[model samples]
Target: MRYLAHSAHAQLGSLWLSCVGWVLTAMALGLIQWRVWLVSDRGVISSGVAWVGVWRACFNSHALVTPGFRVMHCRSMSLAETFTPPEIVAAQVLMLLSLVLGLCGNAGGVYALRNIYFRTQEDSPVRLAFFTTGVLCLSAAVMSLVPLLWNLISVVTNQTIEFPPEFNMPPAPDSQHVGCGIGVGMVGTVLMMVSGIIFCTYRFPVRSQRPGGSSSPAPSVSHSRGAAVNDNPAFESHEDL
Candidate 1:
């Protein structure tokens, strides 16, 4: 059976608190981690791709080659190098936006949850706070998705980089496959979406009342009092006298 929330300020409060965790999880997974993983190149010995994050590219030596020690080589990527066709800057911009929005959403959720928890009497104010948190969370989740989805499309289309006919030096096999970072980002995205769903399910309840006043008037007992007076024999005799 489905139940609806009515006059549920507390429900909104709890939803905001949950939103905070989801927003943070998504941000941490999607924004801070690498962009994608690169398949290990069989042609290369003692070396594999380090992990390609949005801002940098790196490579690592296998443990068998260096035993007991790990080494990684990395370099920062410029917009020209990172994006294919060089003119496509949407991915970069969307990624930056997601980071900012995620932080804002997380902060908003924390503040709203606090208001709901600490100041139960402030119904209107607390309700507003929680609603705001929910909106922020929902928006942040959307913003974070742009980069992840963009990357997925690119990987599936094999469009990470473009090569001219004479560019030579065949592309590395590792570059052909999508990386682990994409999966991590997707997981984060799912968490954010779940938070949004929870918030949406319970919202600021509307007070139901008729324009004239209450839907039903209070019951009257005057008729019962009159009946008792009529039934009293002494009162009837006195009236007749």
Candidate 2:
């Protein structure tokens, strides 16, 4: 019992690391989803494919059910069974959907970036920021699945009934994998947040000038012609009439 308790204690720290990693990853994904929704043109009725829709899709999860907020939290708590028997079929479906969206969104964004660079010799600060953000969110999303993958493998192999009491090997670099994941997730989250700030601050230049404003000097006229029109007796009579 003493050894089991000690094993559980050591494993609990790793569990906490997994929870932290998923939480950070979730935050990034949520931010990416929000940004996409914020900038999408509702009237167009199409995803922002011509722009950075692919990048936006990297974190979009509106239709996905697996690796969702609820499932992640439950699993992080080591309550997989308590959450309706894993829902393997449903989970698989959601995972496939997520994978498709993630791939599409990323591809679209990369293509857009290349198109912009080749067509217009200009780089938009906002697009760069958004792309950076999307990449970070994607990284986080991938990391978020690490614990689930580990657990799934363990279950399939029948290595341990309870993760908390098993896999308590002695301290080593591999043992700190969970910690590294959490750290990387946190970094990704911070990058997304900073990118969000940059995105918000970077604005496109407005085209139309103000009503009374001029971008160039007024054109010059022939002074003699002006004088003739104003001073000629014939023109003066016409003006009077």
Q: What's every prediction's RMSD, in angstroms?
A: 6.8, 23.6
C-alpha TM-scores of all predictions = 0.62, 0.30
Q: Which runs of model 2 end up more than 4 angstroms from their true locations? A: 1-112, 120-178, 206-213, 220-241
Error (Å) of candidate 2 at residue 205 is 3.3
Error of 1 at 210 (Å): 16
Clashing pairs in 2: 54-105, 54-106, 55-105
Candidate 2 global CA lDDT score: 0.34
Candidate that scores best on TM-score? 1
Instruction: Candidate 1: list runs displaced more than 4 Å.
Output: 1-45, 61-70, 80-92, 120-125, 160-175, 204-231, 238-241
Clashes in predicted model 2: 3
Tens digits of per-residue lDDT, candidate 2, 1-241, equal 0112221232233223333434454443333121111224322212221111101222222332235353111112222333222323233333344334344434434443343333443445424533553453344344334433543443344331222322221111111112232234345434433433332343333444546786565778666877988878899888889
lDDT of 1 by residue, 15-125 (tens): 554455455544444441343445454332234443445654445544322333365444444566633432124445655665566566667656655554454454555
